[model samples]
Target: MAEANHGKWTYCVDLAREEGRRRTRRRGGFATRAEAAREMKAVLDGELRGVYEDRRTTVASYLREWLAAAKERLAPNTYAGYADCVERDLIPAFGHHRLPDLRPKHIDCWVAAQQDAGRGRVTIYRVVSTLRNALNAAVRSWRLRYNPAKHSVPPKPRAAERTCWTPDEAAAFLRHNAEHYADRLTDLFEVMLGTGMRRGEVLALHWSDVHLMDRKLYVRWTLAAVNNNESLFREPKTEASRAWISLSPRVMAALHRQAALQVAAHPDGRLEGLVFAKPDGLPLRPQWVLDQLRKRTAELGLPKIGLHDLRHTAASIMIAMGIPIAVVSKTLRHTTLAITINLYGHLLKDSADEAVKALAAALDRADAERGASESPLPLAA
Candidate 1:
């Protein structure tokens, strides 16, 4: 036993041997030398008896191991995203910090710093969620006694207003698209808006995924761009993402026209795999798509929206038309109806006036029936 006086407490380090050569140093703090020695001895005995093995591993080291095991359970794209989040956002902030010393105050300060660095609430939320889950895994493995993530409160940004183009506005946008982007790009955008397919799903589409005879688009895979270098195909984010979307006549016509144009341009139908590929017949890059959309919107002087806003627009149109929430949820491939409702609940509330009218009509019918019954069934026979 080695005793040292540090700060206000006496520290004792006990050397204990377990099995043949497994040795460990048990450390503890006490007020007096005798008490420190006794506590250290007890901890050493527990260590030898395999009761407590303090995993003195750091947060960074454990995260690497956790990521390795977690990757196997997730899709390739998801794994890549998680890896990016850890490497870019998490490691720089907490990698060197002592895991046991982390506190809620520390997390709050770090989150504020992140916000100061211009990280949006959505990005910060994702980072915090990833960090929390990583720490949670450590807790489950007994590496940690408490999860600091539970104590941290990342700011929640207010939800943005939902804006969807009306039917006439949709037509105007399509007409402008036909006039400006007259090739496969126009068709691809139209298909996305018409079918409510995600951007990745639209990029992952292949000739085989389309069923002209059945007039359906099979959405089973998505194309993800990693590090802006290569595009890879992976399973959709959720189970509900794998579905069949009925193609509208105009959208089907556009796809068919694009197919003919591609066959004519490439001589071999550009059957290089993807339905919406680059001009050189390679997979479309997400950034390139965004660039095109941005330039086109600028040229047309249209309302500027992100690529994802197209998806929101589709969902908004459905909600405005009184589509059932469950159906919209399934169409959007959300994990739950609650998510769909939460995203578009504001729009649904606008229909409340009609709902009140329905209740009033029901009451009127009941009152009319009651009055007839009380009027003495005059000459009913």
Candidate 2:
């Protein structure tokens, strides 16, 4: 029913209850009676369809509820990221607004404000993504009609180009490590560059997973840091990342050296501990490894590259050696071939040119053969 009260229209309707109890839902402040009636009809329709959303739920409450549910299902690192964005950014921005009252315009204004505040594009993108994801969940649960943040999210930031070493540069760096900084890190760097293993995967490696005689190792765990404060061992990044990786001779050599060093450091240590650990037998911090890499690169007067760049450098070297992209993808343990292509497509330019040239040569030979076969033999007689 719709009524006029104080120059505004109001609508009231009884809500369907599962139990034998009557409940009423009412709304006011529409400019016209028709608008109020339409809204009432829509609410009735939604209730009939079992998708009625309560407008009383604030964004703050909904997000908090959603986060609590998300924590049980999401990975620790992933949940930490979501929690940080929701509590530090999203809730602070629009927590007062009702979930049902959220509009695309509101999301757009927030994105613009973030941009004006000189926030990093990647940071803004991630926070908006968190909002969009939470709102998507609300839409799926019928808590909201639609996700207002869906179309209003900022564009994802492009990955920055990574600096990778050439074969000579890599060789020179390894040699320098061997001569000057000959320690466990020397072997660690050798294993990283040789196998293209991720920092976490390498750090989480266990001696039991390595087979020196067979020249292979299994990737089972990855060490993840939560908020850069605490470390935890988690499953591999993907199922493919858990598969066996064939070790190169250089990698095998590094492992042997690491084994010797481990024996000298801890004669009574068990074999079940981490392959790469500090003196206290705890996993080495990823940040500390990066810091050492920076310090060494600066000392060597080489272009500064992060530890992850060693993985890229390995992929580049393999691609340059005419290795098949599929093989390279498998070697790198990429979940998909497209990922390898996307990351190293620029390096495939020469290979692509060679393929086209070979095709052109074959076509030219076919054309010449066809012309010779069609020529008249009488001229030669």
Worst 10 residues of 2 by lDDT: 1-10
Off by over 4 Å in 2: 1-45, 377-381
Q: What is residue 265's positional error in candidate 2, in angstroms?
A: 3.1
Query: What TM-score does structure 2 among the candidates reach?
Result: 0.87
- Give each model's whole-structure lDDT: 0.76, 0.89
Q: Residues 62-100, candidate 1: write the lDDT tens digits.
A: 678889999878776767877887888778878776665
Candidate 1 Cα errors over 4 Å, as ranges: 1-55, 75-81, 112-120, 266-272, 376-381
CA shift of 262, model 1, Å: 2.6
Alpha carbon lDDT at 277, candidate 1: 85
Query: Can you write out model 2's per-residue Cα lDDT over 239-299, one digit (the tens) per residue?
Result: 9899898988888888988888787677675465888999888999889999998888888
Clashes of each: 0, 0
